[model samples]
Target: MTTPENSTAPRPIKATGRFMLAHPAHIIAQGFGSGLSPVMPGTFGTLFAWLSYVVMTTRWPEIFTPLNWLVITAAGFVVGVWTCQVTGRHLRAPDHGSMVWDEIIAFWLVLVLVTPATLSSQFAAFLVFRFFDMVKPPPISYFDRHLKGGFGVMWDDIVAAFYTLLALALWRAI
Candidate 1:
């Protein structure tokens, strides 16, 4: 059956590059096309977060102070809420794997806490964060299953970031 033109029902979307560019929300929610990767789009989005965070902080060190990063990351989360919601509606999936803004913003938060370290340390953070995110142990898995809509899509990754931070803290203490 054909859906009504004005119906609020979400329609399945083919997440192509064309679709990614079709709307501003799509661009942001899709991690500027990094989410188009057929394999491990979330990892790609997190990589984009790492590279972009490094570039921005290195290129504009004065502006990307820890405080500024807090602000920027907070703003990104707020924006991701809206963009993910809108994009999710368009994609007909509350948390489409291709919508990686959650990963991007969440990883940005993770990196914000782990900077001023060696490249190896940063890579470790990447690996740990990816593991927590992919495995979704305990509370992360609980929230991921129960939470709904844009907030749900974005929040699980935040828990993964927390787990990453906790793991990093424990490693540092050891």
Candidate 2:
């Protein structure tokens, strides 16, 4: 039996192995594509945080003062919710990996106490903050799990920052 001209079989979709650029959540959630890295996207995202901190601490040290840090941390918590909700809706995905703004803000929160005037101290603080963030022990883990949306995305890192601050304080005291 001959098939009709309009009755051709549908072709199977072949995987193109191409990376996607325009996500529903806009560029922010994709960490400006930093989150799309093949490995350790979080680290890459944190680098952005480090650079931002360096700039802020250098150019606007007064804004990063102890009192300002508290204000910034609180602001981060509030804004994080809006950021997360926006990205979540954009990507149609809950807490997409590309949403690294939260990570940046959270790391900055941790560095508030230990932020050093010297480059070496800044580097040290960055490393320490990264370590604690990665480990996510105790309360950090609790926050990570219990919170939802942007708060959930950012909470663990915030707690990690607190832990790092405590450790740094104790270390300095010794």
> At residue 137, what lDDT does model 1 achieve?
100
Task: State which candidate has the highest lDDT.
Answer: 1
- What ranges in model 1 sit over 4 Å off? 1-11
Model 2 weakest lDDT span, ten residues long: 11-20
Global lDDT for candidate 2?
A: 0.67
TM per candidate comes to 0.91, 0.71
| Candidate 2 clash pair list | 24-90, 25-90, 29-98
Q: Write the per-residue lDDT of candidate 2 for residues 7-71, one digit (tens) a residue.
A: 55553221111222443334554455656566776777778777777787779987777688678
How close to the true structure is residue 54 of candidate 1, measured as C-alpha lDDT? 89
TM-score, predicted candidate 2 vs. hidden true structure: 0.71
